[model samples]
Target: MSFTVYNFTNNDDVKILHQMGQFQVLQWDRDLSLAPWTAQQAWFASQMDVRRRQLIANLDGRTGVTLQAGAMQWTAGQIQATTGVKGAGDLLGKMVRGAVSQDSMIKPEYTGVGMLVCEPTWQHLLLVDVAQWGGSIVLNDGLFLACDSTLQHALERRSNLSSAVAGNEGLFNLRLNGQGTLVLESPCPQTEVLYIDLQNDEVKIDGNYALAWTAGLQFSVERSGKSLIGSAMGGEGLVNVYRGTGRIMMAPMQAATSYNTLASQPTS
Candidate 1:
């Protein structure tokens, strides 16, 4: 199908961040042109480094794309949407996973030759390659946006019970495996994200600042110090720990609050 998206790529306000395979991440550099009343607010937002971004999925007739439910903003050129459920058992599995992970219960799949655009958001958008993570990756809570349908999706359980309770994280995390591009709605921008590669080593984080990590890494929650008294004295109680050989995507700037919390607050 031959079609055109006028002003989408040529517009001065939009900036393309990353594009590969079936996904493209776009950012609105500035939104100060909206109106007189909001111009000052928009300028301040830009100065503070707040970004508004969106993800566009380009689909071919042979390959499909899966997106978080309610994420689709618009589509063009003969696209079809499906629940991506194979059977009753599949539906039950997704429902349980969604409840525990706090993800959308039903992710819709779009196929055919067309372009699917997701709703724009204030949070930063990141494009990840599954193959680069050794063919698999485990995601932190609520980072998933959209992914190529060729990847496999499953739940990865925390290494220990303490991780779920002490780390302030869920017992299960969403995992994607295979060779495909995964889109993430990150709490921080890619420039601020710290990537750590470990070889039979361990890394300890005082808070839930990790965005994603390699799938096989052992994750747990432990005291920050050798003893309880020492931990209290050190002013750190518990920390999220990752052990073994793998990689970690962390955002240290978000130690105090998440982007979602900041975005939800009323702005004068």
Candidate 2:
């Protein structure tokens, strides 16, 4: 019937970084540590970039939110959960998609007047509006965090066999359709992201840096240049190429390097 989160506000260390409609993204200012690690924590905090854990989808009952299975940290007030599966057919479809995509089979949905908190991590949290993304957004294997109940989820495969084999990404990616706000846990900070909007054009990347792209685009693995010799001379073998008119969000840095930098920026 009532809920009050003490010492969590913009005035405090824990601030509301962003809010879209009913969804609120709360960011902690500093990393918390135990007494034994105080000295180490202080040294690291001062020397390295602080990677704060983010909370997603603080609900207040105007609408409902669906979360990746087991993502919920805590919930308060009048909120209830559902399996988000319509029937036996939907369950079967989810199971099949889960098998290929490696996503949750039965994501839980929560509704009514309450605050839904998600497990915090060092990963960056991005709140995307599906309508602005042309009503469909396909994400790399493991980014889906949470979304409004209005959105729909499906599994989409790469455009060709070469993409599946050479791109070094999974055969099936998670696709979110319909209209609503979707929460994403990006590996890299959004400040470092490069968004490419193509109009009947093409863009290529050497690695799996492209996090999410519009479903309308065609993604395949192709040589860097026209001929085999040219590709070899270019020093780039096969690259993931996205063609057609659509939008893509790419993190320019290599995945492992960026993650290490975020997770543990070593002292210089």
Candidate 3:
């Protein structure tokens, strides 16, 4: 019942970017100590604009947190983990959803009054309020990190088949519904993200730069120009289009780049 974390919050090297409800996103301002050779690598990483960030999940005994499988790094106090499975049928359903959505099949849930920390990564951690998205939101692939267990999860399919095949996005997306906080692993920093609010309007993008959007929005893929000749002349082909009224979170930069790939490489 009694616990303390020393040199965690007090450490000058760590910067707290966001904290809400039961989650906190922190970033290490710099790696202070390193060998000469590794220090050179760190300097190059700095020049390349890389970041070291982590997510902290704080359970309050009454509420539990659901995380992507294999995301937990460490935990303290009276914490317990469960598969969040109800029955054989539920497991099968989750498996199907996971297959189409490209998300972890069985998300692990943690309960009890404790602090759970996720593995550190260079990817930016974003804390989103589901309520801000009108109690529901659909996320692009691979963005889901963690969420309050109170939220409901479902698969949201594309508006049309062409949208799935031509847009470069898959057929189904993971949708979360309810009033809770959701954590996302973003390829771009929050500062670089563009937030768009639409009112019976539409927006088009040449690539999959959208991170998340309101679940009610109608999404599809379409030509950038009215005709094939125009599209070819404009040098633009299919584009992702969102219609209706909702909010969108878009990153101006491409999601796949050297910065995101660096996480897969071993680090000293």
Sorted on TM-score, best first, the list reads 3, 1, 2
Q: What's the residue-level lDDT of 135 in candidate 1?
A: 95
Which residue pairs in model 3 clash with each other? none
**Per-residue lDDT of candidate 2, residues 136-240 (tens digit):** 999876778889998888877778976467646677888999998988777766677889999999998887788889999988888788988998999997888
Q: lDDT of each structure?
A: 0.85, 0.78, 0.87
Question: Highest lDDT: which candidate?
Answer: 3
Q: Which lDDT tens digits does candidate 3 get at residues 1-268?
A: 6799998856988888889898998877778767777888788888776867889988889889999999899999999999999899889989998888779999999999989999888888888999999999999888899999999889888888774686566888899999899998887887899999999999998877899999999988888899989988999888888999999999888652234567775533
Pairs of colliding residues, candidate 2: none
Cα lDDT of model 1 overall?
0.85
Residue 29 of model 3 has an lDDT of 76
* Global Cα lDDT for candidate 2: 0.78
TM-scores for all predictions: 0.93, 0.87, 0.93
Q: Whole-model lDDT, candidate 3? A: 0.87
- Candidate 3 segments whose C-alpha is farther than 4 A from its true place: 47-49, 256-259
Clashes per prediction?
0, 0, 0
Ranking by lDDT: 3, 1, 2
Error of 3 at 97 (Å): 1.2
Q: Worst ten-residue run, lDDT, model 3? A: 254-263
